[model samples]
Target: MRLEQKYTALLGDVQRRAIGGGVPSAIGQLRLCFEALGLASAIDADCATRLGRHGLSEGKFVLLSLLRDVPEGLSPHALAERAGVTRGTITGLLDGLERDGFLARHADQVDRRKLLVRLSPKGEAAASTLVDEHAQWIASLFADFTPAEMQLLSALLEKAWRKTDRGAA
Candidate 1:
């Protein structure tokens, strides 16, 4: 069977199981899941567009954000960990950012074998602007949620993320 057919079959099985149980509505749960997915996609698209306006992509944003918080800068391995990207990917990103006049790489004084990556003045200004823009965007997005609701949502999302992270590990 095709991928869609397999997915539908699995969903149908879950729906049947839910219906057989005391649960009132599996359709509502499915609808909520799809809605959340749609919201996530929209947010990702908006983020990509905003980052692109600054001549950066999501990966670059992650790298720049990490650098913004660290004055001394970070090594490729440290950047990879902070950005949740591969070491090779971090290297490429640092190279591209450096070429674009957004960052610089220097040999680590303590560890000569490792290269430390730091943002240039231009990069720092760009990152600061992006951070402000993102903060405003996030505030607008969550404007409808009350403080309690926001806290609950944050907790729930963190719990789900932890579960997924554990499963992946």
Candidate 2:
């Protein structure tokens, strides 16, 4: 059975017992379902393992991912804000990536106080290879789903994520 099905079955039991026990409300139930999405479980583990083989930690992987999407790269503050991490955390991540020769930090042309980050050639190559491999791995996991289904799932998840993001802000 699928991971979600397992969680759903357990939720069914909870729903049945809601009358006797103070079970969660509708919103709470959705929270449970979201928890079951398990982004930190198999998905992170698999990506961590893969990145580990290249001497990259999960934190570094996340940093690299954010950088890869933008060729010009982000400032340290911007990176931290977008990654939902602290400036100190971004510093550490950048230090490691820089030490490993994956990225470079330089003064911003227009604003010297603000630093700019950019991927080195090595970083670009690594990001390209790793992203393709990760995409394939993710696609295989969701192979059972139709294109339409995947699109709907993506839309719903993005909506939920946006809501959560707004709440955080």
The candidate that wins on TM-score is 1
lDDT of 2 by residue, 62-162 (tens): 77778897887789899899889898998999999999999999888888898899889888888878877878987898899999999998888677667
Please identify model 2 stretches exceeding 4 Å from their true place: 1-40, 147-169
- After superposition, the stretches of candidate 1 with alpha carbons farther than 4 Å from their true spots are 1-25, 155-169
Task: Give the 10-residue window scoring lowest on summed lDDT in candidate 1.
Answer: 1-10
With candidate 1 superimposed using the best TM-score fit, by how many Å does residue 144's alpha carbon deviate from the native? 2.5
Candidate 2, residue 164: how far the Cα is off, in Å:
11
lDDT of candidate 2 vs native? 0.80
RMSD (Å) of each candidate, 1 decimal: 5.5, 5.2
Query: Where is model 2 poorest over a 10-residue stretch in terms of lDDT?
Result: 25-34
